[model samples]
Target: MGIFKKPPLRGGKRNAGVPDDLWTKCQCGELIHTLDLKQHAYVCAHCNHHFLLPGRDRIELLTDAGSFEEMDHGLYSANPLGFANYERKTADLREKTGLNDAVISGRATIDSFPVTLAVMDFKYFAGSMGSVVGEKITRAIETATREKRAVIIVSASSGARMQEGMLSLMQMAKTCGALSRHQEAALPYISILTHPTTGGVTASFATIGDINLAEPGCMIGFAGPRVIKETTHQDLPKGFQTAEFMVEHGLVDAIVDRTKMRTKLAELLSYLMPQPSLSGQETLG
Candidate 1:
């Protein structure tokens, strides 16, 4: 042998020069790997940036382990007008995202306090609200009322689903109607807005919550920035429609980072509906 080459020492250790495949640094200066970030509840470690979470992932993060009971799991979209490619698009999106629709609705507990949660997944056609989405959300609210549980909604969307045409636009009114019922029940409805909440979703149920919370740097508005600027011929303020701007303008209650969301929500729920004692009185009393 030619002095038996030991794989050139492999950079002094086995696999020593191989780059790690898991970890990545976000633009916000946060060091996170996939699994580690998931373990942190999809929050960036260094900057506490709230990563855009899937609807199901949000439920997993907020709900008590194994406590979530999905409502309306089988509901799906229908192409009433036989619009060309609409059905195929819906089917493809369902397969790609593994979601029945843009919204996921269910009943669960946060910190052991019963609540109903609905989250929108932007991956599902940019989270455009359609008839099925509106129906599912309304039904979820009804279920929560029957169970006497608080309702929480996490909104992340581009707008109404244009593919569904008028049916999609109808969701705006329907969802708002459902939220009105929640108000009538005196049940607290908390809305947490993520990045790019706009269009009919923002115009309706997204803003109807009793307490509105938004993630930092999230854009919450009914219209696109350019469209508004072009319409009014005025310069939009710096950070317009940002979470901080919403807070300053009294639109959003607070700007919460992802890391503290659970704790904050628990506190809010506690304040809204404190636990009852054995005598049917609040312990805080």
Candidate 2:
């Protein structure tokens, strides 16, 4: 008989003095402490997997401390089509997430460069865009236009909310219309496409950025690959919907490392901002 029976350790229990919730296993099979993972901006150091950032976290990561001034609050979706149990589900999510909708729109300074920011919260119903999400984004863009500042929208969504029916689908046109005016004003509209930015959102304003940037390994597509495969009955190209793929195919402009995004945005904004015209020296037609 063994002198001591060994306790069977499984899953994260393999480590001692580490709480299960404080640690998570990455897709690359590396076990990382949550604090350390957070320190790395939730990227898997081993495989460079970019974990999705929540809307609020994204705002903090991109904007200067205390520089964000939020607008368009308390706009929640109603049961426009009266989808069964949708109101109950939305109410539950609102209570859980403390957000009235899937997107947070406001003004903030990125590296002291003024911008109107709208970050989509995937935790809220997969970051689905319904009436409120569309309205908030439209308002944000219009506000930026009036203020003569740049616009930045970080998208992390599966698609439009199904419960709202046509109302949800209509956001595609509404947001695009707002962006058209912003473009006409010569103000930059930067769209940061994150993991799983797909469906109607992709087909709309997500891909029309003046400078569209995406995170490494983000999935940007109108439909899931599986559905495309099933529909076409053809062998799919490897990693066809990834951010890298999108860049190669001209869908995305560039892929930025999550950690470097703030610096990059500042640099871009600096370059995009009109030069002072050599200290009042002016000429031209």
lDDT of 2 by residue, 1-285 (tens): 564675555665557785658978888899888888888888888998888777887888899998898998889999988799999999999999999989999988787667899999899999999999999999999988887778999999989988998999999999999999999989999999998899999999999999999999888999888899999999999989999999989989999999899999999998886543453313211
> Over the stretch 120-227, how does candidate 1's per-residue lDDT look in tens digits?
999998999989988988888877776677889999999998888899899888878877887787878999999889999999888878999998889999989999
Span of ten consecutive residues with least summed lDDT in model 1? 276-285
Candidate 2 segments exceeding 4 Å error? 1-20, 275-285
CA lDDT, every prediction?
A: 0.85, 0.89
In model 1, pairs of residues that clash are none
Displacement of residue 214 (Cα, Å) in model 2 is 0.5
Which residue pairs in candidate 2 have backbone atoms (N, alpha carbon, C) closer than 3 angstroms, thus clashing? none
Model 1 TM-score on a 0 to 1 scale: 0.86
Strongest candidate by lDDT: 2
Which stretches in model 1 have alpha-carbon errors above 4 Å? 1-25, 29-31, 274-285
Candidate 1: residue 259 Cα off by (Å) = 2.1
